[model samples]
Target: MYSLNKIIESTGELVSAKVFGKEQNRIFQDNFNSIWEKQRDSKLNIAVIGEFSSGKSTLINTLIHRNLLKTGFMVTTAAPAYLFNGREDYLYICAALADRKGYFIKIWEDGGKTVVEAYKETGPGLYKTLSKDGRSWIEYNEHLQFPEKLEDILAYMTTVEDAVKKMEKIEIFLPRNSLPEKMVIIDTPGVNPGKKDSSEHEMRTRKILEDIADTVLILFPADSVYTQTFEDFLNKNAARFMKHAVLMITMMDRVQEGEREEITEFAREKIKNKFHLKDPFLLSCSAGRAGKDEYWRSKFQKAEEQLMDNLRKKRERILAERTAGLLDNLLQEMNKTVDLKMEEITQKESRLREASVPNLRRTLDESYKEREWKIRAVKKQFKKSLSDDKEAMKVQAVAKVREELAKRKKRLDITKYVQNEKGLNAAVTESSQGMIGRAEYYCDLAGKKTLELKKELDEILIKYYGTIGAEAENEVQGRHAGSDVSVINSLIGNAITDVQKQENKNANSRDKWAAGIGIGVGLIVGGPLLAVGGLFLGIVGGDSLFVESSRTKVLNSFSAALPEIADKIEALLIENVNSAVTEQSNRLAAYKDQLEKRYQSVYDQIVGNIESQKAAVMKEKSEKEEIKEEIRRLKMNLEQWKRSR
Candidate 1:
């Protein structure tokens, strides 16, 4: 079997051959590089996510056999905490200084030597600081020591309100035996923060799960099992999470002994039926009693073993599968390009044998012009349809936002906002931030709709001028028989077989790709919501005096501002939707242009080859033969690689 390194190297060679367009090759190279880096690092990131008080922290504490994370009835985790295995027990406090930047304050000790260093952020996860002379770099600080004050510092940085606000994340390093080597456990803030409107917390957690996590541990308290909020979260991210997630029923000790089996069985049924997971990996344990209770200890051991097994086995499988899928797609597309080029050459040769140079040139020009007109018409209709979609989407989005705000209004604590102007601003800010998830949903919807429209346009073009190998094969076979038809048919057969194999190997991979696209759309659309909070702050800041007069006055002021707030949200949603739609339209146009250029290049090459047939017939034929040979070689290599695994 070919290793991932060998596969990646082969892919790089093919990409360098210019099988794809410039932009496409660049994208493939970036993805391949990322895969290579991840494979080289060989680290598994397991993110634990849940609702407030869902035993997420307790589970990590149990695994590490340390009471490091703070736990309470309220929302305790303020930022994501990364736990890693190390030689010494220490931690780094990452304080957020600005967007995508932070200061890392490291505290550690070895023997009698203590190290406390502060590094200013210079790049993403990269840091540097000024030297004592203020000209060079050095790593040292005199603020604190390790072990003695580590717990205090961690608690303050991770849980305390004021300290938490300044913190980006907490990185805890423990003894080598504390965790599996090359494994990092990330504890994220609860997605459902009970009564607290902490949209930032949810967004941060969602980002981690979607982008960073290799495997996810979703915790559900045994006492409560699956709540509607949890179900909703799963529904939204089901494609990304279900394949990589392990459902854990934590705090099992809280449930009655007689009902434990029943509850576990019930949860399993829900996973299989509601979530459509046929055989989900699940564990029930009481992290709080794992150290002291024998039965709970056994359960915890099982959970730990399961995690270790996934770390050892699942990571390599996922990487291999992804790499194979990528290579297969690249090779198939390359083969298709070769087939199209061959078909063009054959068509031009036939025309050259029958017509004079001037007549052949005229015929090619007319064909090009007719196809170009069809493409233009398709693009025009596509743009108009997207514009219509933007308007309709805006109306629906506004209605949804209004309904959500109305629900929040009934539950609003008027007295809380009436306390001060800051409180009122915070309330408005939270309300606006709360719409981010909804905005992302709308963006994802628009993205899918745009893709569907683009697909329709592509189909229309395929109907008018068939560039796809199968369609071209039928046309060519109708005109010429024997060897040419055989070659084209074989190429199409192999391409079809490869696609079928990919589909059979895993349908989930395509779902993952779609989910990734949704994440990109969400980031673009959700960004405006962050500023929506500040936008509303300006509108409601003037009403602070009226808000402070009485709870009734505060409610009245907020109610009056609702229409304006709704209008603002509608405008932002429309703007965001428009931006997303325009981006997709531009991409479609680029794709169409790329196709046109590829075919045009082939036509020009055919024209030149025919014009110089007396002088260059043998040379052009030899070059065409080499292309066919290369296509055959690539197809064989891809098939062999797939079978070897």
Candidate 2:
């Protein structure tokens, strides 16, 4: 009866206590975030992806029956563009300005038929201008006179050399007649080597395919054979892709009239053999040719219908899979924690038997002496472990920061950010600020770990105290056990409250922890594709544009500055963590004294306490089994639904 969001939140809290491997943790966060976003935004995203010269833009243009997207025989779209409809036609742009300064410009049609009649408005300053250099973001927009202007702006925005600086993605809002209310059609940059060669572009394209694409149309020019890039893309993502994929054999008009049918069959059969798609959509277009629109629509009608049907089913399947994946992760962590506790309990029991009382009367006083050396050793080890953890965390923070900067170097046009004197300072300052932010995130994570360590130490003390009480129970029970029971009961109650408080603290801080985890995560499907950091956009002006040669110099400067930035961040994190660690250590040290005082009163009741603890653990384990059974039922139901569909 639990809601998915409630379960997700609980799972994040439960599993986040332990550090999974870096890669596993990143995957979990990305998947978790993806599912979270999916539940929040239930839009069907159909991504059009392919090599350059594959007629992807033409397909979109034909679908909408508007030449809104610029197309040609070469690479036309420079960046990924999104097309969807809004209540009114509007343009929202994040413009890249000098020194990474950008503007969020909005141009809207105010009850006008033409683009020229649309008015531009900054309106109540819904956006901010970045000038301080640290983490600069830009946005810009302006009205257009005609629909044709959309093509012009899109062309300019997508070109690599002339592309707007830090213009990450473009969103076009049109009338309901032009777009489906629940659908978003994405036009991605070509991934072919001879076309868009940038690794960043390739990464972005792959990321869309892997993470966002509800349905993918892999386009190919009809006259040419499939390129290696397309082939490799299929090879890598065949399992998931085959479910919602349709190979589009485009530009069929180029095929000789007598050979068109043969070519279509050949392409279809080739796709079947290599990629497993049996019926490739055969499409050809002559933009200005008479009745071409009719021909294009007629050719695509069946395929379009099938794609829509497949997309709906696929979305449902994805939701189920994502939810199950999260549960699987949570279950793993729970099992690990339980197994560890059980092992510790067994060890304590064994130690108690080995050191059993020779004489019951004398053993009561000596029980406290038995655990003092063990407790002291544990306290010492805990301090050393904290120090080592601090060092490891510092190293991880620095390395993560460096990796992100390196990724940015590949994703962002660094030269553009440093083209002018102001820009150079701004880029450097932003880079430095980014480094500092990364350091702070890890330092906070270490502080949380310190809190967890304190909780753990408390548990160890309680367990060890229970062992001492078990040994002395026979000797002290008649006189001491019944009267002083409240003392040990109070300590145990406090320990449980501390654990509950820690869990609440972790849940409250989940957002920050999630953001920190995102710092180390990159898009999983592709290499550095999307520039997630500090996006800038706007009309290119004020000396922000750069030549190709300047990129090397700007990147070199960033590379040189990175280590220095990382060093400062590392030192800062270490200082912050050390301070937190010192405070936690003092608190834990005081706990030792509290434990000794409380235990002296309950010397005879330790055996009963141990029995109670074991009973509670068994109850918890049984509840976990029920939860596991419920999850199994959910999975079976999901699978049944998928099969029935």
TM-scores of the candidates in the order shown: 0.48, 0.45
Where model 2 places Cα greater than 4 Å from the true spot, the runs are 1-30, 89-102, 107-150, 193-196, 237-239, 256-297, 309-314, 324-628, 643-645
Instruction: Please provide, for model 2 over 376-487, each residue's C-alpha lDDT reduced to its tens digit, 9 standing for 90 to 100.
Output: 3433443444445444433543444344334443213332233233433333333344333443444443344434443453444355444332121111111111232233
> What's the lDDT for all of these models?
0.58, 0.52
Error of 1 at 381 (Å): 45
93: Cα error in model 2, Å:
6.5
Against the true structure, whose TM-score is highest?
1
For model 1, the local distance difference test gives: 0.58
- The candidate 1 region of ten consecutive residues with least summed lDDT is 472-481
Candidate 1 stretches with Cα past 4 Å from truth are 12-18, 21-26, 89-102, 108-149, 160-162, 194-198, 325-645
